[model samples]
Target: MAVGAIGVVFGDIGTSPLYALRDTFAGHHPLPLDQLHVYGIISLMFWSMMIIVTLKYVSVIMRADNKGEGGSLALLALINQHTTGNRWGKGIILLGVFATALFYGDSMITPAVSVMGAIEGVAVYQPEMHPLIVPMVVTILIGLFLIQSRGTEKVATFFGPIMLFYFATIAVLGLVSIAQMPQVISALSPHHAVEMFLADPFRGFLAMGAAVLAVTGAEALYADMGHFGRSPIRMSWLAFVLPALVLNYLGQASLLMRNPAALESPFYFLAPDWFQWPLLIIASLAAVIASQAVISGAFSVTQQAIQLGFIPRMTIKHTSTAAGQIYIPVINFALMIAVILLVLVFQRSSNLTAAYGIAVTGAMLIDNFLLAVVLFKLWHWKKPLAIGLLTMFFLIDGGYLGANLTKIPDGGWVPLLMGIAIFTLLTTWSRGRALMRQGMAEGSIPLEVFTKSAHSSATRVPGTAVFMASTVAGVPSALLHNIKHNKVLHQRVVILTVHIEDVPYVEPAERSTVKDFGNGFYRLTLRFGFLEETDVPAALRTVTMCGEAFDMMKTSFFLSRQTLIPSDKPGMALWREKLFAWMLRNAASAMEFFRLPTNRVVELGSQLKI
Candidate 1:
């Protein structure tokens, strides 16, 4: 698992040596390739990794996992469970959602930037290869996305060893360069970083923006924790990944100190001429693996968001029986388009850098905020201690965020814009769902009243009819519509309400609560962990109190399809209501999302305004 963490969890940060230092000197925010700048930037990268990745995430944040699951959403759910249920808790929830929105932006840019940075090595091999760089990156990216449908486990089995090799190779390469310019090792001192910043505050500050690239994928340590577990990821990072990355950055700095012109491409130049091509090949593979991790994270986020009701359900195809190995065609194709467009527009890795760090830094800041919440409210840490720890984290994250903000006009706006757009959609969907429930609740009838009074009033049909509802107490809008239109109720009416719990996984024993409401009516409330997929028919088989076991062929599932009409009623803005309506129009049908038997499902449409 430690080895696998090397392959999947650390890909983005591991590959940073490929362009991180190079961009510091030659990127849009260029700095002098002198010893002061070299030492300062190298020192900044080293401490950023130690402080941000090691201290904040691995030590503090990873401990905040939600039922062994880690990520912004999972963490949000966990924190939401513990915090004040007033507007303050809602505010934190919004922050977490926006962090998730930032993640989507990061997800899109990671593939484009990481892959392009790796392929740009060809330019070092031969400057004439510049024109082919974009095409090669585009081809590789398209191929990567195209193969996402076919799960990565088979290929991922070998990822650990391959990435281990890549890390070892880079470490060795760094050692060789450090040997030639041993003085570069002195840059490890915090003094150099402070001195350089003091010497030229503005340039050092701007360089801090590019230096952030070193720890770009640090969040993955938390995001991908579920895949490899906390122990493996932390062990891999502390033992191997951190050492290799630090050495490589120092080596790049050493190479620059010896010959300033090496700033053109210090990573490639650090390699012996004969080994450059092999290094490039290994680097490209690492980049693809890094991109793979981010892409998979995107899929996981989409699944979580849907289950948590932040996004509309999309067609989710489980590519493997292995837990969390799933695919969403809509998300896949959409990401592919966004990634390709980013590559085409940015053209070079240096340009992409301007857009890269903003999303990550923003996300890191949000994580710290969530972590503070966990410490005070959930972990029951002393306020002073929690405040002190949070102060330190804020200082580091705030500095990085401030640095990255300087890039907004250059290209940082790309991810910022994307984050805003996604955040809007997510908030709109959530608010709209709340308003929807409110509107539905207005006309909802209690189960006892409906069953006792209406059972005798309606014609009875054979077999069971399951009416899906948002709440267990009320008569489902679908049932109301169905009875009003058809004027009949089935012999057995199951008022089924699926409750997505805040936790990640619920035990089968605790997954359902069945109540016999009497008179051929059974109120069934199915509970699922937020991470668990919902399958109505499957869970229904567990119902012994329903008289007989459920048979898909004999049972008919009824779903309510609400046609949302833009309203002047007190709620969201007019535009947001329209946006929610559009999103609803495109969401996957309930039958598909809940894994119900398609042939046994019936849709009853009703109009609602919020």
Candidate 2:
């Protein structure tokens, strides 16, 4: 299981009762409690959970795995693999990529909102704590990022029990309130939701954006499925988590109807004075886990992005083998900066809520779109069954998205700005890669004659040498530079290329392909699934099974690095080219991506621009 998977995947949606009820009442279109309004809000939350989380994700979409991995991109890859020639593949791919881009935006905002909201509980008990909120949040955020280098193994152990207690606390509180006001149980009816929407269509629609916050991190459960497996997650949701969530929401609403003055923080108001401070600390810690989950997910996604050619390869370190824990320093710090800025700019948790739901709901919609393709095209499910399931999910997701758009003028600009920035980066990197590949193709030299002549003339040295190549056929520019600088050749020379297949998982038999290029020279290519972690050194050891003995200590690895230069070329826009170049310059080296030993690695620089 992922170290903090349960907390990260379930916490955001789990904690929705904290503010969802209050927000719905006092949100963009504040609704008064009629029996119908209460029923409507409850009904919306129920079906939102049903369609967005359960039916669409847990039942249907989760089945569309890329070699037992599920996510927007992974699902996209699965669809593309099965239906490459279909007309809809391109559209589905774009939707998946777009969803992936939006997910980055959500990753940034979730930390800010979750942590800030939990810390904001201080204001309820002691208004004096308000002034220190931002700094405290910033400090905590910094501390969280700092500890990432060390990994989350110890911290993750507490996630399940703590979250279980948190859920139980809310459920008990709600049950108590329900005993007082039995009418709250009636809110589960569908009529209440429809009546509320029809009676005050505009206001009900506007409340959806805020309402959607209740289900913000639902996608994480699906994304992190590979870590915990489908059965455990499914069982957790059905048996304990879902009931607790619904009960707490109902209890909060029941309490509100009796005491509208409790509108400020119904979550805290539910607790007694003795329990408040402890609850605050627990909630705060839970929020940190929630934030950490998304941050780590961003790292995993970034690795996938690089593998699929949407981004450049970076140094990815696997922090733990048992838990599939990973840490990417560049991504960690980047997320830290963005999250802190979000907290500073938004100032309050309530304000951040506006920006939180859009990206998540948008991504969920894309997931449904891709899942439809999986069900009908890939899984070969009955078309009517797939259509029926997908339609329900789309309508619910559409409502949530429609609701969130109203928040744009409010504090919603935060996610929109982040989304645009991320989308630009993703598209630029993807396009830049295509152009670079084209340029490399034009410059490439055929290997047949060069290999024949070079192999016969070159002298053999003492040990093995591994050269990292960008392509299978052409000699890497780095190899040429290395040859010029050091005329001496190793006794055994291997040209190695690491390729990230667009699919999610690569079969073991297809992991690598090797050819004897005559003399002591050999050429090898390593392939990885988008969902599988890449450890080049580990892969090299396994190549021996394929009839290649890779002696690590004896192998000296060489890689090519490009310093991007902008030219008046008919390619990408000048600004994007510069941006791609900037990103490339700062990216981690191939030695790290391939897990080559530091002492034996060599880098060669070449100038290229798109």
Candidate 3:
């Protein structure tokens, strides 16, 4: 598990040595390649990881996992359970959702930056190969997305060993350079960072934007805590990943100190002539691994959003029998296009790096807000300690965000614009779904009342019928439409609703609940955690509680497909209502989403306005 965590979770931060130092010295806000700046940047990078990744994420926030799951949505789910009715709940929820939106922006930029950053090493080794960099990056990234449909289960076995070698190689390179200039190790002290800020606060502030690149994937540890437990993640970080990253940064600094001209390619210069080619190959592989992690993270986040009702359901394919190894074609295509455009427009990793800071820092800042909720309300930590911690985090996160804001015109706007667009989609879907549900429920009859009245009027059929509902209390429109049009009810009638819980996994023992409504009417509620798949047919097979057990061949599933219309409602604006309507139409079929038997499935459609 520790090795897996190193391969999957640390790939992003592990690969940062490629460009973190180079960007700080020669990025958009270029700094002097002198002793003070080099030391200052190194010190800043080290402390940033300590404060942001180690202390904040590993020690503190990982404790807020939602039933062994972690990430903004998972954390928000945990907090929402406790603060459902509080006035502050809404704000925290929005912040969490927005953080999720910014993550989409992060998802788009990571592949572009990481692949280009490593591939550019070829350009460094032979300047004649520079023009091929963009095409090579585009080809590699396209290939990566194309192969996602084939599950990573087989490939994942090798990730641990490959990443282990990569980290060990970088550490060895760092140690060799540090042996030549041991004084570079002293720059890890906090005083140099303070001195840099004291000397020129503005440059220090600007560089904060660049320094944050080193910690871009810090959230992955928390995001992937459920994949490999916290013990393994913390073990991997402190015992291995963290030290290797810090050493590589220190090595890059040492190289710059010896020859300032290495600023153009400090990372590549760390290797000897014979080793440079191998280093490039290893780094490029590492970059692809990092990109794969980001792509997988995006799919996970999208699944969570759909389960949480923040996004419309799309086609989700389980590429592997493993729990979370799923793929979403819509998300994959969107990310591929966005990432390709970013590469084409930016034309260089340095420019993409400029755009990268805002997306990550913005998400980090919002996470600070979520942590405030965790500390004050959930954990109830010591007041003084929580206050001090929150204050420091806000200042650091805010400073990074503010500094990155200055890069808006310098490619940073790419993420900000993407974040805004994605946030609108998320919030709109959430709000629009709420309004739609409320509208649909307004005139709906209760299941118990309807069952007592309607079972007698409709003719009883031979087989069993399952009608899917959004709520347990109300009758599904599909049942009404079926009874009214055909005037027939199955001998065994099941009114079913699938409820997505706030937790990550609902135990099979507590998965289903059935309430008999007398006669042939029964209400069955299937509960699933946000992270779990909504495989209805498979879940039904284990249910002995619903009499005679579920036989898919003899049972027919009925789904209500709502045709949304733009209404003159006060809940959402007219334009948003139209957007919601369009989204509803394009959403994946409930039959596909719930994994119902295609041959035994029926869809009943109804029009509604929200």
The digit string of per-residue lDDT tens for model 3 on 1-610 reads 9999888998888888898889988998988888888899899999999999999999999998898999999999999999988998998999999899999999999999999999999989899999999999999999999999887889988788889999999998899899899999999999999999999899999999899999999998999999999999999999998898888888888888888888878888999999999999999999999999999999999999999999999999999989889999999999999999999999999999989999899998899999998998888889999999999999999999998999999998998999899889999999988887898899899887898889789899888899998887788899999999999999999999899999989998999999888787888889999999999998988777777888889999998888876566557888888888888889999888998888999998998877
**Candidates by lDDT, descending order:** 3, 1, 2
Candidate ranking (TM-score, best to worst): 1, 3, 2
In model 1, the number of clashes is 0
**Poorest stretch of ten by lDDT in candidate 3:** 563-572
For candidate 2, lDDT tens digit of each residue in 1-610? 3323456578778767766777778766677766667778888888788777887778767776666787777777677777787788777877888898898889898888888888889998898879999999999999999999898878788887788777788888889888889888888887888998899888788877777877778898888887777887888887778898888888877888888778888888878778899889877877887888888889888877778877777767777775458888888988889999889988988787878878888888788778777777777888787788778788888878887877888767767777777778878888887787777667766666656666656666888888888778787777667666776677777888888786767788899888876767778899987767777888888886323477778788887777777667749778888888887777777776666789989777888755
Q: Which residue pairs clash within candidate 3?
A: none
For model 1, state the Cα shift of residue 278 in Å: 0.5
What does candidate 2 score in Cα RMSD to the true structure? 2.5
What TM-score would each prediction reach against the true structure?
0.99, 0.93, 0.98
Worst 10 residues of 2 by lDDT: 1-10
Model 3 sits at a Cα RMSD from the real structure of: 1.2
* lDDT at 115, model 1: 97
Off by over 4 Å in 2: 1-6, 85-87, 457-462, 481-491, 502-509, 531-533, 545-548, 566-568
The window of 10 residues in a row where model 1 has the poorest summed lDDT is 79-88
lDDT of 3 at 233: 97
